[model samples]
Structure formats: structure tokens, C-alpha cells
Target: MNTDESNNKGNIICGRCAYDANPRGATHCQKCGTPLVIASVPNSDPSPASDSTLLVGGISVVATVLFFAIGGYFFWQQVRVASTPSNLNNSADNISSDIRLYNSMKEVPKVPEGTFNYGGAVVFAPLRNSLHKAINQVYPKFGLRFTEPKYNNPGQNTGITMLLDGELSFAQSSKPLEDTHYSKAKERGFSLQQVAIGIDGFLLFTHPDVSIPGLAVEQVKDIFKGKITNWNQVGGPDLAITAFAFNPKFGSSLNILLGPELDQLSPKVQFMRDYTDGVRKVSSIRGALGIGSTGAILGQKSIRPLAIAHGNSKSYVPPFTDDGKQVNATALRDGTYPLTRRLFIVIRRDGTIDEAAGVAYTNLLLSQEGQQYIEKAGFVPIRN
Candidate 1:
């Protein structure tokens, strides 16, 4: 064998025959015709270059994974913070403010810059005195004003009539709006809307000296209807029951208490000029009973309120508390008292200054501060 030929770079060797010196690109050995195998170049190691490439690729993959993991952790933290109770509460408050659509006296909407005449039932006197003064103090630049009826007694019916006649910008009422009131406002080229702002109830009252158990609602109704004329019929002395009530024509108490039966009152039921007059008469006359505003009757020592049961049910709820001095606001608010009713603010929807004034007044009354005033006035606030 020639050593120089075997040492050539392009030489092929026959591994089966153990022969060298095969020509370049030969597939078999020439001497024995055995299959040839190509030999690799001498001293050419690739481990350093291949290992460096692998390391670089591994580092790139790890860096990419870490970057994504860090970004994901920060994103999760942000989501957790956004769902916290304080943030959720802020979102809920924003939604509530958007839905309320009304403002309190402190944040009152734009109102007409002039005096506005307003009046209502005598039961609202205390509320008006407190609420109106606060309104004036909060909105002095708005020039809002309130006044009573100039020509007659302030009452539910009177205030509504005056509002239809354009004598008042708004009115307060202890009774629900009637069909006749709607018709009258329609005849005057406008519609009347009543917004409930508080809860009230009618109180069955008598002289402090009258001693008797509580009466059923039906028995009280029968007494007022002249069906039961004797106090003995309702577990009292054998004295004749003289039922006195306010005139339904002027006051809304009978209308609210008796509903459509306002005209069914017995001829024996004497009509008083006002609640004060009714209280005075009942306190002075023996065996005399009358119905008046719970708000007005509370804290009156001369007269006593009776516990009233619903129909024949034995659960008698008194208009006053157990001590008989303060009003049973809980019962009235929960409708446990059989004589509960709502008080409203009547507004004219004629797109005039009166409407703006009335809406502003209603918004103020429906505010939290205004409801506090209502509670202070001895009436149950409609809002929590």
C-alpha cells in the first residue's frame, strides 16, 4: 500500500476488506470490490460551537417564559385590586347617583330665581317650618320661598284647589290624589302629579277621662256610621257614643279614613272646623270620640288615643307607643297600624315656572336631609 495515497483527504476506505487507497467518490474497493465508507476530516471537533448555540437558545426560552410569568402576575394583581370591596362600593355609588335623578337641598338643581307660593294640609305645618327654613339656608341665592294660603285655611283640599287655580306653585297633602283633582287639573290645561314623601295615620282619640278597652276597626266604623250608638256596645259604660269628625269637604281626614264611604257617615256625626276644634270638643264632651291626624294628636295630654284592631282580629295596634306619648312610628311605617296613609307633594306639570319650582321643592323634600326633617316633624319618613 502507498502511504501518500492513503493519507489523501478525499480517500475512501473499504471497511469490510480492511483496504485503503480507494479513489475519491468511489463506492467500493478496487482490489476486492467491497463496499466503501467515507472517512471524516481529522481533528475537526464541533462540540464547542454546538454547545454555545444550545446554551443561547435555552437562555432565550427561559427569559421569554419569565417575562410572560411576570406580566401575568402583575395583571392578576390589578384584577384583584379592581374587585376589592372599596372599589366595588365606589362603582355602586356611581350607579346609584346616576339612577336617583334628584338632588338634595345641598346639591339642589337649578330653580327659578324668585319667590314661589306653596301651601298644604295643616298636618304639614311642622314639616314645612323646619324643611323650608333649611332650604332657605342652603339655597339663599335661589330665591325660593314658601307661604300659606292668603284667603282661607290651609288644608289638603284647599291647597289642591289653589294649585289648580294658579294660586300656588306647589302644595302638600296628607291624602292621595283623587280623580276629581286630576279632572280639575286637566280642565286647567295641565296634569297634577303627587310624590309621596312621608307616612301618616289617622288616630282615634277621645277624652282622657273615657275609660274603655280597645275597639275593633269595624266597631269604630260602625260608631261613626251611627250603627253602634252606645259605648256599651264596645265594652264601655252605658253612655251614648257621639262621634265627631272633620268636615270632609275641607279636610281630607274623613276622605282618607272612610274612602268612598265619606258620604255614608251617619247624620249624627258632627263635623268640626279643624283638628284643633275636634280635639277640644272631644276632650270636653263625655263619651265623645273623634279621628284626627296622628302627627297632630301626638303629645296632646287632654285627649287620649285608642288602640285599634283590624276588623275582628285581636291584634290591636295603638297609634301611640306603649307609653302613649310618642307616635308608634314603627307600626305606622310597617303598616301594622290599620290607618296608615301616605303624604304627598302635589306639583303642576304645565312646563311653567311653577313646574320647575314644584319639581325643585319635591326633590328637596325627597332628599335624605328632607326626610330627616319629616321625622323631626313627628311623621314617618318614606325614605330609609
Candidate 2:
């Protein structure tokens, strides 16, 4: 070997098996066959082979650092988005505030100045009276008036018929329009639209002489079905239980309370066409029991509302609660009390709505002031 080459070969050392150093130009240890490298020379430039290997390793390191940096940035962005607050609750609050403001200012008038005709369910008699009083008190100058509801015996069917026949401008119902009513109205080229105005809970009443404190839903069904013939069977006096009800075909509070069971009512249940007669029958007969709207039963001292349990539970809940002598408004509204029913104002779908008088009266019932009258008359106001 040349002298220069010999000097280069003398510089290499093996890191592994250090007992023997390799020749400076050798790539591996002579004794252990481990890879060897020359110690760095202070003033000399490295050979091209060493420079190429170091450049490839440096590039690999830079690429790995860039990949990690990009991954971390995307992960942080996703977390930031997930942590942001939502405005959904805020939007709901703003909407409620706007409604309150509109109601307070009377900024929007639902009806224009004009007279209108209306009729419907007899159950809405108290509500009609309240609406009449509200109009006289609040909008007396609007020249709007509602005729006392008529054709109210079997009120729902009667009112729907009247409205379709053009005898009434608008109708009120304690129940939604029945399928038969809809079909009849469609035949007459009109559709019925019902707007909810308030809520009423149907209450069961018994003569003061009857001593049962409360009853479960099933027990009530059994009593009306004549399975429990005597009051004693359901925890009352030994007298027979005389069940009074409206006509099976009539749409009344009793029909609502009984639901499909109305069709299955005991043949013994005496049917009346008028609720007033039913109430009187219940009061005069010592063993008589009846059901009617809470509003309708409020003032009669001869009968009392009986508490009802949910399903077969032992809990007894009254349809109405009074603090000493005043009605508990909150109790009626929260729906904790069962047997609640919705009352609706029915209008023609074919442009017959009284934009000024009809719409206004409807809106009045929905307003805060109007709801007060509804409550005063022994019905629960519809919640917004």
C-alpha cells in the first residue's frame, strides 16, 4: 500500500470488542466483525461516502419532526371547536322575552274592529262568559261581540254542524273535531281548524251522602261498568251506586273521562242529555255518582269531587285544590293532577276566520289577562 493509504488505515477503532482496534480504512472489526468508524479529524474534510450517509439520516430526522408538528396542530384545532359554547339556549330565551314584550305592549292586534258570530260546546259556557267580560273590559270599543253559544246540546257535533251550515262564524269545542265531523265538513267543502285556548280537568263527583273518599282508575271503571253494584263494594255506604252520565253518543266531559269505555258503560248507568240535570241527579240521589268538567262542578255545594289514584297506585289526587277558600292556580297548571282535557276554538279552514274579531278573541284567551279570567272561572289556563 502507498504511504498515504497506510496512514488512513491506522486511524480506525472498533467500538465493540475494544480489546482490538480495527485498521483505519477497514469498515468492520478484524476480530469481532462489528462495524467500525474513524474518529473525527479536527481539520480535515470528510470523504464523500460519509457525507452522503449523514445527509440521508438528517433528512429522515427533519421529515419525522414535520409530521409530528402537523398532527399536533390538527388535534388542537378539533379540541378548540369541541370546547366552544352553544347559543341554542340563548335563542330560546330571546324568543320567550319577545313574546312577553309583545303581550305587554299590545303591539299586535289579532282582530280588526268588527262584530262576529260564534257558537260551540256547552262546556265552554264559563269560558265564553269570561271572554265576553274580557272584551267588555279590555276592548269594549272594538265593536266586536260573540253570540251566546247555541245548539250546544251534544255540543261538539252540534257546533260543528252549525259552523259548516253557515249558522255560526266560529265554533268552540271541549274536544277536538271528530273524524265524522271532518268528513262531513270536507263534503261541505270546508276543513275544520282547532286552536287550543285552555285546559279543564274532568272531575268525578258524588252526593255528599256517599262516603267513599277516593277510588283507583280501575275501581272507577268497575263501578261504572256495574261490576261493583253497591257503594259498599268500593268502600262507601251499603246503598247501591247510581251512575249518572250524559248520553253515550254525546261529546261531554263524561265521555272524555270514560274514553272508549263509554261504549261499554253499564246498562244501569242513567243517561242524561243535559249536564245540569246530571249534576242535579247526583245531588238529589243519595247513592248517585257522576262526572263533569271541573269548571261546571265548582259552585254546587250538594256534591263533592272525589280524588282519583293514578292507575292502581294508592296515591289519591284531587282535580282541584283550594287553599282555605281560594283555588290553587299552580296545582291545576303543572299537570300533576290527572284527568286534564284541552278546550279548543274551532274555525273554518276556508278563510272564514274573523281576522279582527275572531282572531282577536282567540288571542285574548291566550293572553296573560285573558288567562286570568279562565283561571277565575275554574279552568286551568293553557301554558305557553
The best candidate by TM-score is 1
Model 2 ranges off by over 4 Å: 1-115, 141-154, 273-275, 323-332, 353-356
Query: How far does residue 53 in candidate 2 sit from its true spot (Å)?
Result: 72
> Which lDDT tens digits does candidate 1 get at residues 1-384?
111122334454545444455554443344332223233334434675322111111233345346546675754444344233331222211111111223366765655678888876777766766777888888765554555667766688888888889989988888877768866765665666666778888889987767876878888777887899988877788778878876676678777667777677899899876677888899998889988878877788888788888887768898887586677898897778888778877877676888788777776876778878888777887666
C-alpha TM-scores of all predictions = 0.69, 0.66
Candidate 2 lDDT tens digits, 1-384: 001111232344434435233333443333322323233323344675433112111233245346546665764443333222231111211111112212421533655555666766666766666567557665565554444435345566566677778777677777866657766665765555556667777678998888776888778778777888898887788998898776645456656667787677789988766568878889898888887777877776778778878776768877666622334345556665666777876656444444234445665665667767777778876644
Cα lDDT of candidate 1 equals 0.68
RMSD of 2: 27.5
Which residue pairs come into collision in candidate 2? Answer: 9-24, 9-25, 12-24, 111-356, 112-356
lDDT of each: 0.68, 0.59
Query: Over 4 Å off in model 1, which ranges?
Result: 1-104, 141-153
What's the count of clashing pairs in each model shown?
0, 5
